[model samples]
Target: MLVPLPSPPPPASIRTQVEVPLALPDGSTTTARVVTFNGLVDGLEHLAFGLGRYAERHTAVGSSPATPVRLHSECLTGDVFGSQRCDCGAQLRESIVQLATEGGFLLYLRQEGRGIGLYAKLDTYVLQDVGLDTYEANVALGYAVDQRNYTVAAQMLLALGQPRVAMLTNNPDKVAQLRRLGIDVVTQVPTGLHVSDANVRYLAAKARHGDHTLDLAQLTGAGRARPRAAP
Candidate 1:
């Protein structure tokens, strides 16, 4: 029997909106609005950035297609401290730079360690050091390989008045989940591989098990590679 999916509840409204100056990597500056939203049910606060009047442009009559959007999950270690254990920091910076010119919104969700939380993520890293892959370590801890849920992301998009988006991501599951949650993902812009010796194996594990679209040879240069810093 076919059962209909229930509609998601109305997304919470923006709690605060403020404009601020943003410096781009290219030595240019632009004004962007930072909007904070609080989840109605979960109470998690998410940040949405309206880059260079992106909200105004998108809300204009006959605006072309959906806006370019990046749904980036928060990674405290990588994003804040520039840890090279994964490509999270690099991807976040890259997204900011690209969105500066492309004019889009970035939803920063607090889904650390793919929704397993920080403590478990650190424990998983220890297991990974002892010869377990990322997914295996999660299962060993009695959690799903990826505990992330995109319902909040979809709701945030709804709140931003962007029902569709050209998503920037390497994970196919993100696109699939957003669509299942009723957001129209018009296109996918791949966040290219940012490989480092500290994260090569980590990225490889994601590609193998997590269905991330990555070209290992291109990333690793076709050999057993030594660790290199992200460019």
Candidate 2:
């Protein structure tokens, strides 16, 4: 049985998609209110608490309900105010941009630092500095390497009438897990990483240990980064 996820406060509606101006370097931004679906169980408007509702958000944007969807875990530091520690912010930005063009839904699940939470994740950072890889860092902190659960994703997909998906990810585990849950995974939308000095180590660890299915050789074509080699 799935762990009973906590629900948001009684108000059925938790988001007000207000059009606020975002002060950007080049310009401002107009976006849907970013809600913590995992943080507040009932925060998502019309999203009834259910099996995969934790990390999934469904919206009926177009009159027709054939819009594609994206399943993204929570990366608080990156997804929220931009943080250069990882490529998460960039990937989140890219996903939003791409999804906007296609008119699809993005299920932003709250799996901060792959569900380890910021505080403990920071401790893991200390372990990383001491030569521990990302997974090892988590283990050092007495946590699973990847504490994320995709059952909520499956539940949300079914809820949004997206019983299928053309996933935007490089991780085969995500694809396999979703498939196992009976979500019709059409294909993968390889969202490449924007190589940066700060995130080089994080990205390298994914390829080396995290079992992510990104082709290192292909990444090299886009100018391979010399990340801090993990111990």
Q: Which model scores highest in TM-score?
A: 1
List, residue by residue over 1-231, the lDDT tens digit for candidate 2.
123233212122233322222333325343443332333342332222211121234443333333455667777777777777677777766656556555555777766787777888778888888788888898877788887766666666554456656777767777777777777787766776666666666777898887675556544444333322221
Q: What stretches of model 1 exceed 4 Å from their correct place?
A: 1-5, 23-30, 55-63, 222-231
Best by lDDT: 1
Question: Which window of 10 residues has the lowest lDDT sum in candidate 1?
Answer: 222-231
The residue-by-residue lDDT of candidate 1 on 1-231, one tens digit each, is 012134564566767877777765447677767888766445688788877447343445224677889989899999888888888987877777777667788889888988889999999999999999888999999888998877777777777777879998889888888887788899998886777778888888888999888876665653233322333
Clashing pairs for model 2 are: 8-42, 52-152, 55-109
TM-score of each: 0.86, 0.70
Where is model 2 poorest over a 10-residue stretch in terms of lDDT?
46-55
Q: In model 1, state the lDDT of residue 73.
A: 88
Candidate 2, 6: how far from true, in Å? Answer: 20
Q: In candidate 1, how many Å is residue 190 off?
A: 0.3
